[model samples]
Structure formats: C-alpha cells, structure tokens
Target: MVDVGTTLEMVQASQAGMSALGAGLAVGLTGIGAGIAEMAIGSAAVGATAENRDVFGLVLLLTVIPETIVIFGLVVALLLLF
Candidate 1:
C-alpha cells in the first residue's frame, strides 16, 4: 500500500537518523579514548613530578596532548552534522 514518494521519504529520513547516530558515536568514542589516555598519563605525570620538580612542566604538557584527539573528534562530528 506504500507509494513511491512515501518510501523515498522514509528512506531519506532513515539515512539522516543514521548519520546523526554516527556523529554521536564518533564523538563519544573519542571522548572515551581521551579519558583512557589521560588516566594513564596523569598517573605517570604525578609520579614524575613527585620525583623531580623541574619535570613538572614537561609532565603537564604531555598530559594535555591527549586533549587534541577529542578536539579533532568534535570537529569531525560537527562536520558530519552540518
């Protein structure tokens, strides 16, 4: 009983929904990945800083490196949505 136009519209709507889902997944997974990386890096940074005061700056820089991954993911998701 479905007409061609209705079927086409339904397919288009489904595609858009899937695209949104993919964007959400991309951002979510990247955030999780960043968190995991930061967890291990933070522990090491603390240990290094405890041992040597001068290394605190280096450790801080290293700890923030993983943040870029999440930023990139956000950009990708935005691109997908727009």
Candidate 2:
C-alpha cells in the first residue's frame, strides 16, 4: 500500500479543523440570535413608549429571550472544549 499513515494524519487534521469550525459556529449563531433579540426589544420598546410608556418591564423580559441563545451556544462551546 502507499503509506496509509499519512492519509490517516490528513484525516485527523481535517477532523481538528471541523472541531474548530464547530466552535466558531456556536459563537456566530449566538451573535446572530442576540442581534435579532435586540431588534425585537427595540421595536417593542418603541411601541410601548408610543402606547403607554409603562411596559418597559415586560419589554425588558422579552428582550432578554435572545440571551438564552447565547447561553446555549456557550454551553455547547464549553462542552466541546472538554
């Protein structure tokens, strides 16, 4: 055979690259989610202000929903690390 060990090393390297990519995806996806959440919050805040200016509390909670995405992403990243 044509020295299969080198081919194995190449496959391992590719796997390593994939792991790195997974980490990047976690953070990137979370960032996208966070951005979306912020947009919703902004819209709600605007609407609340226009309506009664007293629903800031409810809007704040709704805005924080996106943060869960980041939290989940972080957990995935941490799991991958170890």
Q: Estimate TM-scores for all models.
A: 0.79, 0.69
Q: Residue by residue across 1-82, what tens digits does model 2's lDDT show?
A: 2345568777877777777788779978998989887897878787887898688777778878788888888888777665
Model 1 scores worst on lDDT over the 10 consecutive residues at 1-10
Q: What's the residue-level lDDT of 73 in candidate 1?
A: 87
lDDT of each: 0.89, 0.80
Q: List the residue pairs that clash in candidate 1.
A: none
Q: What's the CA error at residue 50 for candidate 1, in Å?
A: 1.7
Off by over 4 Å in 1: 1-6
Q: Mind giving the per-residue lDDT tens digits that candidate 1 earns over 1-82?
A: 4456677778878878888998898899999999999999999999999999999999999998999998998898888888
In Å, residue 70's CA in model 2 sits off its true spot by: 1.5
TM-score of 1: 0.79
Q: How does model 2 fare in lDDT?
A: 0.80
